[model samples]
Target: MQLNQALEIFMHGEIGIPSAENRSSRQQLAGLDILHSDDVWNQQRQIADEAIVQSHAPAEVLALLADYQPSVDHRITLVDRPTSEHAAYHAAGYRHSASEVLLARSLNNLPAPDPRYAVAQATTIADMEWLNTHDPAKRAWLTVTRLLEPRLRHSFIRLDAEVVARVRVCQVDPAHSYVTNLYTAPNYRRRGIAQALMIAVLQQAAALGECWSVLIASEAGLPLYQKLGYQPLATLTVFEPAEASE
Candidate 1:
C-alpha cells in the first residue's frame, strides 16, 4: 500500500472516545471533532486544515488546498511520504512544525507476556476513566463514545488489581490496526508493564485476524518500539502558519 494510505489509516485509527460528557462537549467547541469521509479524515470546523491528503489527488485539489484560508490561525497536518506531492506541500509555504515516526510490524510473532502483570480489556467506563485520570496530558482530548466504539479496544495492565498501564488499539480496516496511548503510571515505570501491555494487545489483534499493527512513537518511546520489531515507515509532519508556531 502507498505510504499516505497507510498513514491515514494509522491516523484515524488513533482517535479515542472522550472520557467524560463534559470533555466531549469541550472538544467540540475547540474544533477537535474528527470527520471521516471516504479515505479522508478532517475536523468538523475548518478553523484548521487538518486533512489526510489522498495519494493521487489532482493538481486542482492541491492548488485549492494551497490557497484555502481559515478565519483564524490554522495548521495543516500531513503525512510526509517520500513523494513529489509531499514536496509540493512544503513548497507552498507549509513549514515543518513537528513530526512523529510511523512504525509498524506484523503480528505473526509477538514477545512473551510478563507474568508479573495481568492485562485485560477495560470492562467499564470507570476503568477507562481511571486510566485517563492517571495520564491526563496524553488522554486529555479522548471521548467516552470513541473508547466504547466496537472497532476500538482499550486494554490495561494491573498489579494486584490496581491498574498501572494502558494501551489502545483501533482497527482501522480488516487487516490494519493502529495502537496508541501506551502509558505507564509514574510509580509503575521500569517494571516491564508497557511491554507486557503491548504484547497482550497485539495477541488480541492477531486473534481477530488483524495481522499488521501500526503506531506513531514518541521520541522517548522509540527504543522500546524498535526493540519490539516496529520499523519506521515514514515521518508524519504537522505544518502551521508561521505565526501560529511562534
Candidate 2:
C-alpha cells in the first residue's frame, strides 16, 4: 500500500469509535482530528488525549486544543509531520514525550507460526483481565481497546504460566489490520518470542482475509519489523504538557 493509504488506515484505527459507556470521543476542530479518552485506570501512563495534524496550521490546532480542555491530564500526539512543524507546539509548552515510526506490510506471504509455542487469543473481558494480572493499567487499556477498536484481538504466548509476549491486532476494515502494543517481558528479551507471536498475528489476519497490517514501532523494535517485510511510512512525534515532563 502507498504511504498515504497506510497512514489513513492507521489514523482511522487509532481514532476508533467510542465505547458504549462513552469513555472516549473523537472530534474534528480547527482542521485537526483530536481524541480524548478518560484514564479509567487512573494511571499516569494511561493515554488521555491526542491531536492528529493533517493540513491544519499548527497555531490553529494549538488554539483549539487549548480551548477544549479535558477533565483529566492529557497529552497530544502529532503524527507524520516534520520536526519543524512541531516547533510551534514546543514553544506553546508541549514538550516532546516520544517518537515512533509508522510501519506497514502486506500480509500476503506471512511466515508459518512457530510450532513449539502455542498462541492464544484473548476473546473476552475475563480472558484479558486474567492474562494481564501483572498490570492493571495494561489490562484497562486492553479492555478499552476491545470496546473501541473494530474486530479487536489480543494474541499472546505464555512461558512459565505467564504471558511473556503479546500483540494487539485490529481489523479496522475488510482489507486492513492494525497492530499495536507489541511487547515482551524484560527478562524474555532476545528470545525470539516477539517474532513468533507477530508471525502468528499476521497469519491470523490473513486467515480473516485482511490484506495489510500497520503499526508504530520504536527504534528498538525496528529491526524485527523490517525482517518481517514492514516498510517505514513516517515518524510520529508525541508531546505532552511541559509540566508533565518536568
Candidate 3:
C-alpha cells in the first residue's frame, strides 16, 4: 500500500471502540481540521488512506494528516505481535500536546450555548439506542472501532473504519503520556469541538497520572494548547532517504 493509504488504515486500526455510535462520534468531532487531502479533504471530507497517522488519538478523530509541527501523536503498548516474529507488546506510549488537552477540557467544562448540537457522555461505543431514534441511518456509514492501537488487525475499526475524530482516555494524569490526533471535520467547523475533546482527553490523562501528555499542535492549535498548559519539548525533524520511497 502507498504510505498515505497505509497511514489511513493504521489510524483506523488504532482505538478499541466496539460500537457504531462511537464510530460516528469520532467523525462528528473532527470539525474543520485541515489535514484531509484534496481527494480526502474535499467537500466530502475524507482523508488520504496513507497520509500518515501523523497524530494519534482514540479511533475517533477525523483530520488524519500531520499538518502542524507536532500535529500527530500515537500511543503504542508493548505486547505480542501475532503476525510478526517480534515479542509481545513492547511499547506503551501516547502523543499530543498539553495545549490540545487544555483547550478541549475548557470547552467541556462549560455548558454548550449552541442549539444545533447535542452532547453526551463520550465512550468507545456510541449509544445505538439514541441513534435508532435520532439518527438511525447515521450508523450505516459509521463504525465501532477498537482502540486505535497500531498492530491490532481484527478490531471493529478494521472492518469498516472511515475517519479519525477524538482520542479519549478513561484515566489520565499530567505526568502520564498519551498520543492525540488533533483532527477537525469539515461539516462541524469552528464550533470548538476539537477543544472540547482535548480538554476532556487531558483531564482523563491527568487523572490517570499523566504529568504531561505529548502532542504536536498546529500553529493555530499551538497557542490554544499553550493557553491550556503545554510547552514544546523539542522539534521533530523528518528526513526520508531518497531510496526509501523506492
Candidate 4:
C-alpha cells in the first residue's frame, strides 16, 4: 500500500506499451518517472506522454518540466494528495485537469463471479476490436497491448452475442495485478455486468497468486469499486496545459 509501490504497479500496467512509431518509452529523469506513448495524448484519454513525480518538492516539478518535456501534449501525474504543487504547476503553464482515486483490493478475498452472466476471455486483436468498436482510434494502441501478451488479459460479458461489458487486467507479477479499462455499455449499466466482469478477472488474478489488484478510479466508479472491497490508497492529481488565453 506504499504510494510508490502502487504507482509502480500503475505505471507498469499503463505505460511501456510498444508502439509502431517507436514513440512508447519510459525513463527516470530529474527525479521523475517519465512515460511517453504514441496513443495520441488527450486530456480525456490519458493513455500516456506523462511524467510521474513521487516527491512533493516544487524544485522537482520545475526540473521535470525543464529537463524532460516529452511533448506539449504531456501531463504531470503527481502521486500525492491535493497540495501546494497547484501553484508550481500553474506557473509552469499547466492547470489541474483532474484527480483520480487510486484503489486496491487484496486478491485473497475476491468475490466469486456471478455465474448467471457468462464471461469470455479475449486474447486477440479481433477480440479487442470488438470491445473497442465504439472507439476506433484506439485499435492501433490496443494492437500494441495485444503484443504485451501473457501479461495482459481482457475479459468481457456478452448479451445475445453482443459485448456488453469488459475489463483488462495486467498481472505485473505473481503478487500484483493492475486493473484498467473496466466499462459497461450504457444500456447495460446497473445490471451487474461490470461487477461480474470484475469478479471474474479478480478470481483469475487470485488463482495466479497475485496478492493485490489495483486501479485508478474516476469519481463515478469509486462507489462501485468500494462496494467490491477496494480501498482507496492515494489520490493521483493530474496537471495539463491550461487553455490558451484568447
Instruction: Report, for every candidate in turn, its global Cα lDDT versus the true structure.
Output: 0.63, 0.75, 0.32, 0.74
- Residue-wise lDDT of candidate 2 within 1-246, one digit each (tens)? 787787777766665544553356667775677776643342233446777665666788778877877444666666666678778888988888888788999988777778878898887777767676843124444664564445878888888877888877867888998898678888887878889999999998998899999998887899999999999987777777888755
Candidate 3: residue 55 Cα off by (Å):
24
- Report per-prediction Cα RMSD to one decimal: 6.9, 3.2, 16.3, 3.6
Cα lDDT tens digits for candidate 1, 1-246: 456566656656644333332121111212222222221112122122354433434354345444543424444444454445556556665566666778888898788777877787865777666665554234532345655677778888767556677777888788888897678878788778888888889888899999788898877788888888888877766555555555
Candidate 2: which pairs clash? none
Residue 239 alpha-carbon offset, candidate 3, angstroms? 2.7
- Per-residue lDDT value at 21 in model 4: 31
Which candidate, 1 or 4, would have the higher TM-score against the true structure?
4
Clashing residue pairs for model 1 = 17-142, 17-143, 17-144, 17-146, 17-147, 18-142, 18-143, 18-144
Give the best candidate by TM-score.
2
Residue 4 Cα positional deviation in candidate 4, in Å, after optimal superposition? 2.3
TM-score of 3: 0.35
**What's the ranking of the predictions by lDDT, best on top?**
2, 4, 1, 3
Task: Write out the backbone clash pairs for model 4.
Answer: none
lDDT of 1 at 138: 48
Decoy 2 TM-score against native: 0.85
Instruction: Give the per-residue lDDT digits (tens) of candidate 3, residues 1-246.
Output: 233332222233232232432321123123322222212111132322211223333232222222322212222211111222112111112222212111122222333332332223323345322322232123222223322322111111100123223333322222334344345445543666555555555554444444434444455667656755555543322222223234
Candidate 4: RMSD over Cα atoms? 3.6
lDDT tens per residue, model 4, 1-55: 7767887888887763455433566787755788776544322234447888777
| Shift in Å, residue 226, candidate 2 | 1.4
lDDT of 4 at 111: 81
How far residue 241's Cα lies from its native spot in candidate 1, in Å, is: 3.0
